[model samples]
Target chain A: MSAQPNPTLSVALEHVEELARGLGESGDALALRERARDLVTPLVLPDRARHLWRYTNPERFVPVADPTVLAPVAIAHEWPREDDLAAAALIAGGALRMVEIDDTARRAGVVIEDLHRAATDGLLGSLVPPEHGFAEAINTAAWHGGVLVRVPAGVELEHPIRVRCVASAEPVSVPRVLVVAGAGSAFELVEGHVGGGVPALVLGVTEIAVGPDARVRYSLVQRWDAGVTGHLTARARLERGAHFQMSLASFGGSLYKADVGAVLAGEGAQAEMFGVSMGGEKQHMDHHTEHLHEARKTHSNLDFKVALTGAARSAYTGMIRIAHDAGGSEAYQVNRNLLLSEDARAESIPELEILTDDVRCSHGATVAPLDEEQVFYLKSRGLPHFQAMRLIVYGFLGQTLQRLPATTRERIEALVASRLHEE
Target chain B: MTDSTNAVFSCADVHIWVGEKEVVKGVDLTVMPGEIHAIMGPNGSGKSTLANGLMGHPLYTVEGRLTLAGEDVSALSADEKARKGMFLAFQYPVAIPGVTVASFLRAAVSARRGAEVPIRDFRKELLARMADLDMDTAFAGRYLNDGFSGGEKKRVEILQMLMLQPRFALLDETDSGLDIDALKVVSKGINAASTPEVGMVLVTHYQRLLNYVRPHVVHVFMDGRIVRSGGPELALELEERGYDWLEPAAAAGGA
Candidate 1:
């Protein structure tokens, strides 16, 4: 046993161990339980360290207080027992409001269910990979409860349904999600986080399974409070002819690290990931993404842009892998950063690993600051320094906004303008 | 005081140094309102430097008095001088990304006027001025000069000059890269901005622009000072004879 781990971490780990045992006696559940037992040992605690915990140390984020005294609480919702949108409802926000999934989805032969019931029915263990060390360990150890979402075959939904998770009065919140979309189904999912005044942490893990011929648009908005730290990991498997579109916006948080991955398990699978991150003050935001092409005729493109101001810092590392049999695959990745101040820092690394010569793959990275001549030109037109900076910053991040829906784009622009005012 | 008494801009014994290279040395220039004055010189003759100095660029060290509308503006920032009714249509305008030309002009107008102009009136004025320049309506929505064609960028600059309505304007090589049609349009725009209350200093390396702009006074700038001041015929003469013949004459006269 590891010298009786820190009180805050020990209790959290103990809670996860107990919960993993109750997640049903399946292959994933048994594997997670065995892993949970090892988490308290010296080998897992000190010997096997994680680069993911480089900042916002997990021990500090998750306090190890007694779990027996913990309260069983569910977020207050406006509607109860509603499954309007397709896809199994996975993790609901701590301060979430349940809404009707809309009449259009109900008429499209889509079946929507809650994650709590899915877990009770043993569907959760089958979706989550027991190999995700930190995220899996975090969820198996400490997730209070979550949602499950499933989209029926051949259903198409026009409007995107958002599941906003706002944090309040919690030092640590672990959220679990499981999403399954059937073949030929199309839907949009937005997972959002909004934070308040509390000093908090979020360990978020999401597992998505995209069936053959399905199209999924997933957007993650991390607008945490300045007092919070977040560690999020999301993974998806795309079968034959499926498409996955992901957009990530990290606009807040003192420290955040997000690990996102996509596995192209079938032929003709395609994935496109886009992200924009803005950091201020002493904030640090890091993103790591991987595209694994295990089959032939797969395609993937990744674009990540980060703007750093004040003394903030950001680091992005992205990789694309083409397996030996994954010939004729096209993969491209780019990471660009705009430095706003002398003290602001940015690091970008775009890498590709290919075992097949028939594949077309390229990766590039760039880091630059606001052009002084451009600022001078604007100032010469009588705009102040701050106004000029705002203009350039907005343009630098406008590419990501162009990837969003019209209404969502407007809302994001308003949010960015409001944040600039705060500065 | 009716015709030549406005004294739009006056520079006395202006000596400018750009990082130890004395570009404009002991020059004197004055432009009275309602008259178009052209400064014709070859490359590296400090014509653009004089224009930039009048706009109060920090890069140039000024050793003389620069007065705009009879007010001393030698010590102001470039933007401050611009707000004080002095404009420079740059030789190569820098593209300011993320800023629309319309919004940039509105901000500049508000800064110059020292108050917020009503949106309705501002919009009306912007449309009127844009139409006057024969500019495409789509130009207003574009990021300021970003990825603009050479001719299109110059038109945008002229549009800004007309909207600001400054007391004195400095046209720095505005006709450098323009074709005949663009040159005609640009000259028309300059003429439109030249009222009895506004004066202009047109700087160009080629005297071909002088044919259309029709300057009342033409000055030859060599080693910064006005080496020779004459009627518009001097520009025509320089176009025929070139600067080699006058360099020796000016040198002899200076000695």
Candidate 2:
């Protein structure tokens, strides 16, 4: 099949060809490699597209060839000692030592480790489901290292599992993270990505699978350095009676495109996705998410709120898809954004596709500045102009942060508050 | 009835402006302890502006004196005014999302009481009050004033006034947007909160509310000033004959 050809898509295909050549002449890896190569020429890219690169200009995230030479991947530095439950380090292009929890998590049958070991042992394919997009194929072909977590059946974790993935150099960090929750299990997983170096590119990917009757609370806090340019793709699958809660906060990045999505694959499953992003100083952050109902009797809700400051820009696009056989399903999507500066810009679009007549689905979005009444209320309480604005904005985002548990709220707010600027 | 000698709230020839346009001009008004006085006026008569100004709204500027219980509260903030036993049941209450009713009420009560309210005692007291207003116990779990009907918001406002036990209150159009049943419930709430220790100022555009909650006196305002002062019969006279009934007196009052 022919796909639209644009410069960005061409650049992506060129990078895929280089990666395929580096993979050498292997058989099993060849299948995944060939799949990626085929996507390079077939996936269409345009200034205005629906699915991939909707929020961000695909040209900015396209990989450019280097004339010098291939550089070696460096290991990331070890994280400082803290009171965190569990921690892992990914420096450069490889995995560091995995942090073992004190005891509670271990007893709860939580397995957090490096994905290289899991992939080498043929466990990655069984854990995380497959993806069919161009970015997914490119990630499957060139990913280096990542974090993997597995929760056993009937196990409940009181503490959140924290995963820190870092990229020290300019390399496609196909950071694949496979999180599989056994049936009847419940847990929280916090994933963060931090990195800094020269003007380089980092492509990140993650696949999550939540088992039947399981509940998985997942959060992704992406605060890449201001100089980094890249795209990130993450997808999740939920089985029957499973519930998934996803939260994302993007604070800093040069040119970033993030695609986050989930699929309800069984009856009685539910998913709620929440996102908050702030862009400043010419930064552009494109965040797209979708919830697909593939079975009957499923429910899903999505809320995304963003703030654009300075000359920065952001785009939020989300979709809720209900299959024809997925009768008796319910879905809702809302995206609200605030434009803080005249130069700042934000666009939000929430779409719904219902193939069945027995389902209820609705989508809406609003992009505007802060409400005058809310601002006046805060000011009447003695806060200055900027302080009042900050309070109102914080209170706006605090809606999403308040949805988390107490401890999780504490952690997420600490990061969000720091990233917020008074003006 | 209590003595009218007590100074519940005293405004000395107050001049107020909203965006360079004078709303309350050289006006004097007072309400003594245990007295419920209703201020009836036509639209643009600044009745609502006066109520909001007393509550320390930043949207208005005041150039005169305001005192509550012998305390000069002219410079006090809204929350500070609340601590001084002054409350306002806004005509249009703001919806504070992400804050549950129980949490906001508890916090407000704590702030007013300056002490932590015991959970059991709080729940017991809140449930009793909810029953008084015919509110479902589940209402406490929803977000504060979020998605509440007009009548429900007014009930919540009165609920706060009742629980806070304020010394002076400004009920701004609290009865403007309620059905007969809701009006009865709201009036009952106001009547319950009206003890000899509290004084209330009811600012409304309609005299229909006066039927449920009788006031000792009613004042007619026009052109940013109170043009005439009379008994409760003045309200009925104005409602029946409309503001045209005051045209002759308004002209004779020297404008």
Candidate 3:
């Protein structure tokens, strides 16, 4: 690992060490925290010419020195069907606060508690891989006061678990979430992220471990403000015969990068991933998705769509990897970009690594402006110029929008519509 | 030439060009209020081109003057002309995958009325119009024209016409792919939208639609020019004899 080029980023690494020392713990938690702190200085910055860093600057996400505000962020955004949720949690200042669990889920052996306290149980960092990159290590070292949700085997929760995370600038707010779905259990999760339009950084990490034969549906919507530079990594690891459905939506941010992937580790496991993002003004968003087939007879599909307007830019990369032993696996990936204006730019890249000859894997990508026939059709119906453009953009992202979690569906939809009207 | 001051829709020496080639060559027509004119022709006769060109489709270049209710509208854009009370039922209405039928109609109605319509009033009006067309009412919630059958597409076109209530409408092959029941339902929608103030131009390759909705005047369009114009009897004669003789008549009349 090379020395940090920026003095401020180097100070950021010292701060992580300082934070780890402040914990003053012994045993596994201290080892994990110190390991992350040690990794910060030795980890090398990704090269500019690398595939993941080709479109976006890697230095923008390096956490800078800022006053760590420990107060909880004010809840300003709207959520959906609040009363019907099985669990509702507010995450900010690296601490999970104001969490409530329904009596039904509580009696059914669903556990929702503080992550730091749960760490001693040897569950923290269980699903997080040891070979993670810089952002994942930084999150592990800096984040605290997060949530750990555990659902016991054979228990099914009818209502979705809702989590609203707010990260204030100047604090380098890092929110961590970990979920464990037991075997033969079923559950749904809806997460919302907000607060980031300042000079500071917001890095978040989420990991889901789907047990054998478990069913899980997870969705997240991001509504950060412009000028907020954020980095988030979300991944799910599936066990034998498990089924997982995931979605991620990003509507606002100055520069936000998301890495969402699913690992099909169990035979006959299936996963579906859908992503939606909209960029306007000077917003820059980069999204990367991966579906790794590590077991035989696994199936996976991914669809990601981005609509860019104004001078906004988006870069999307989708990857599908099949291991040597994963014969008879099927994987498909599709990325579509809708450029609403001439000034707005989009880059679509597809990456695939198939080690086995018996697997079926394919990927497709397209970058196009608004459909002329579609716009003409709308205009002929007496819709004005801007309305026609808005309708077309809305329709371009329709597939992912329709796949959002039911609890966050209404709120996310209204936010998208309001953003379209502003343009 | 005497000016028909009360004519709702009129075009003078209209020529439509698709790319470098001329499709509709110097065709002239006038339609008055309370009138339904069938522009009948066989395949590739430019009937659809004429219909699309008159409504300001971008792919076709039109050279002529089009007037609606005594106001010239040839220089305006498609949406502007639509706001000026002109509508064209497309031969192949494009599919908009995400926008619901109800929402799309709301936008169209809002554009025509120059303001946003109230939701309650819009919903009531939409339900009533759907009932008038014998539609399932669930169609309002579906994405606009996406995955819709051919008959359903035509029905939605008529539904748009009913909602917009334009003074002049150009229907381009609205009956080509309809079954018997669907054809009747669409015919009913067309009839319901045709009021005394509306002038309709129905372009068809056959007289199938005319059997249900009687036309006051019929024009036999051959090779983009109207070779014969008469009362409703012309449509019956063409339906019986077919369009095979039109080339001879077109040649004989030097059209």
- lDDT per model, in order? 0.75, 0.74, 0.83
lDDT of 1 at A270: 98
Every model: iRMSD: 2.1, 4.3, 1.1
Q: Could you tell me every candidate's TM-score relative to the true structure?
A: 0.85, 0.75, 0.86
**Clash-forming residue pairs, model 3:** A94-A144, A95-A145, A96-A145
Clash pairs (backbone) in predicted model 2 = A76-A91
| Candidate numbers, best lDDT first, in rank order | 3, 1, 2
What C-alpha lDDT, on a 0 to 100 scale, does residue A339 get in candidate 1?
Answer: 89
**lDDT of prediction 3:** 0.83
Two-chain DockQ for model 2: 0.16
TM-score of chain B of each: 0.95, 0.94, 0.97
TM-score, chain A, candidate 3 = 0.92
Predicted candidate 2 versus true structure: per-residue lDDT over A297-343, tens digit per residue: 99998878887778888877787889999999999888888877789
lDDT of 2 by residue, B44-158 (tens): 8888888888777777898788888878888887777777788888888887676577766776677678777898898889989889998889988877678999998999888
Residue B90, candidate 2: Cα error in Å is: 1.2
- Tens-place lDDT digits, model 3, residues A246-349: 98888877888998889999999999988888889989999988888999999998888888889999998888999999999999988999998889999999
- Taking chain A by itself, what TM-score does each prediction score? 0.85, 0.87, 0.92
